[model samples]
Target: MNAVIRTVRADEWEQVRELRLAALRDPVAHLAFLETVDAALACSDDFWRERAAGAAETGDGQVRQFVAEGPDGRWLGTVTALVERPSAEVRFGESAKVDQTHLVGVYVRPEARGGAVVEALFRAAVDWSWTVEGIRRVRLYVHEENARAAAFYRRFGFAPSGERVPVPGGVGAYEDEYELLPSASRDAVTG
Candidate 1:
């Protein structure tokens, strides 16, 4: 499908909220996302607006949200890149040991699955990560049962970092960290 991938704008909060709600309602959301549809739906419009503005293209470079817009102007997918410094508070997973970017809120419409749309979104997120000053690598967390997502991340050149963190509110569930780096370098770090 022909889709344009770009950073989200501050004024696109409504679209961002809608797309997030749709993602949370997906069948695999229980494993793919840390939040519930009901919880997301309960958030106020002001909360969404703040979230969108923080990730907007004109906002600080620490965070960015990329969207895949179809030719008809509909949003097909979205991915967020969050820059984590070594000293920053841990939001999800372990605290950053080095400067890096964490990919989150990845979602693609069901109709856009098995196509290049999701790939394009990932490419945009990872490509943007390298542009950030001091960013050493790009990483993301995938639930252990999320085989499809794990496979896709591996195909995209991310290797398991051997780090596991308990999934919040999920008893006995854990998410594994995956990092993108050159093969030679990946082995040294992930090994």
Candidate 2:
């Protein structure tokens, strides 16, 4: 699938909201996302506006959201990179031991899965993460039951980092940590 991968614009909050809602409704959303469709729907427009603005290209460099836009102008996929520092509040799992970026909110439209769109989005996100000063690695968490996501991440060179976080509200369930060191990412993408 031909797609244009770019950072989301602050003014495109509506499109962002629509895409997120769609992701939340996917069949595997229970394993892929932490938030529910009902919870996301309960959020106000201002909430979405702030989210979009914070991740937009014009916002602070701490966060960036990349979207794969189809030829028809539809958002086909998205992935966000968030710079994490030891001193900053942890958004998930554990506090950072070294400078790194966490990949989150990953999604691809049903029709766009198993295509180049997802790879393009990951390439864009990982490339953006390395641009941040002092970033040594990129990381993301996947539910243990979500084999499809885990497989893709493995193919992209993200290996288990030996850290696990308990899945919220799920008894005995966990999300395993996967990390990609800077050098490994380069080799993974190019080799």
Candidate 3:
């Protein structure tokens, strides 16, 4: 609960990669993330370095990554937000519906799950989103079966937009999209 929550540094790519791989190994990783542990582990060092650089504070408004680090200097969790431009097509769903921030790569170490680490990460991500000039809302998708994640999102004030993205290959799966509009009162919704 005493962890420091802040934006990631460009030089901390190895830390980013380490925390992400730990998240992938979580029991709920199947429901919470798209990438497998093997895939994450196989990524080149350059890939992680570039990713960290892109999400660093110095990267400007394009992308942002936030982290919660314990007093011991170990990273307990991380969340990344990507700024979706109006001129560009959205990555996962139907093309640009709005210029927004797509929240992704959310994770918390199991030992840190209930200690407010996730909430702190969300605060950082949402704060970053609000700083963007034209962002209308901050949105994220969760696997339909991820009740814990859904409950956390709801508790944090995200609402299902009633939009669903089918899992590719027709595996009879879907991910639900949730959003928190910038016009909404953040305190009223998330408290």
Candidate 4:
């Protein structure tokens, strides 16, 4: 598979919205994503446009969205990373103890799995995170029941931190948080 992993441009909001909706429709979306396709589709164009702009190069440096584009320019996957300042209140949980990056909205088309598309996307996101000043780690959450995702995250050097977030409801609906400290080493490519 020939694909290029790059940051999205502000003008590509429509594509961003489309890819997100596509991701939501995937079978594993319920386990990996927090939003539904219907909810995403209902979002006004202005919302998507603003989101795209915020993640683009021209926007603030605190957040970034990366995509894997096929040789034909079709989007195969995407992931977003947001930089968390030490003093900033965490968006999803408690206050951040260290400057870090939160990895979220990870997805890849089923047809594109095992083609290094995800690895490329991670490389781009993690590399960008490392470039941010004061960043000490990069973290993400995965549904506990999604063993495939947990294994993939472990393969990428992330480990469970023992800190869990309730799935906004109860015990039966929670996801486990996993983190990768800046000191951890990552293989540039995995077979």
Best by lDDT: 2
Q: After superposition, how far is residue 36 of candidate 2 from its true place, in Å?
A: 0.5
RMSD of each: 3.6, 1.2, 1.5, 1.5
Number of backbone-clashing residue pairs for each candidate, in the order shown: 0, 0, 0, 0
Indicate the residue-level lDDT of 167 in model 2.
90
Candidate 2 lDDT, tens digit per residue, 79-108? 999999999999999999999999999999
- Candidate 4 lDDT, tens digit per residue, 1-191? 59988899999999999899989999989888878898998899999999999998888998899999998899999999998876787787545788889999999998899768887888889889999898888989898889998988888878888888876545477788888876563543353
The runs of at least 3 residues in candidate 3 whose Cα sits more than 4 Å from the true structure, single-residue gaps closed, are 188-191
Model 3 lowest lDDT segment of ten? 182-191
Off by over 4 Å in 2: 189-191
1-191, model 3: which lDDT tens digit per residue?
Answer: 78999998999999999999999999888888878999998999999999999889888668999999999999999999998977986677545578899999999988898768888889889987998988888889999999989998888888999899986657799999999886552762332
lDDT of 4 at 82: 92
Q: Give lDDT per model, in order.
A: 0.89, 0.94, 0.86, 0.86
TM-score of each: 0.94, 0.97, 0.94, 0.94
Q: Cα lDDT for residue 180, model 3? A: 87
Candidate 4 achieves a global lDDT of 0.86
In model 2, residue pairs whose N, Cα or C atoms come closer than 3 Å (at least 3 residues apart or on different chains), thus clashing, are none
Judged by whole-model lDDT over C-alpha atoms, candidate 1 comes out at 0.89
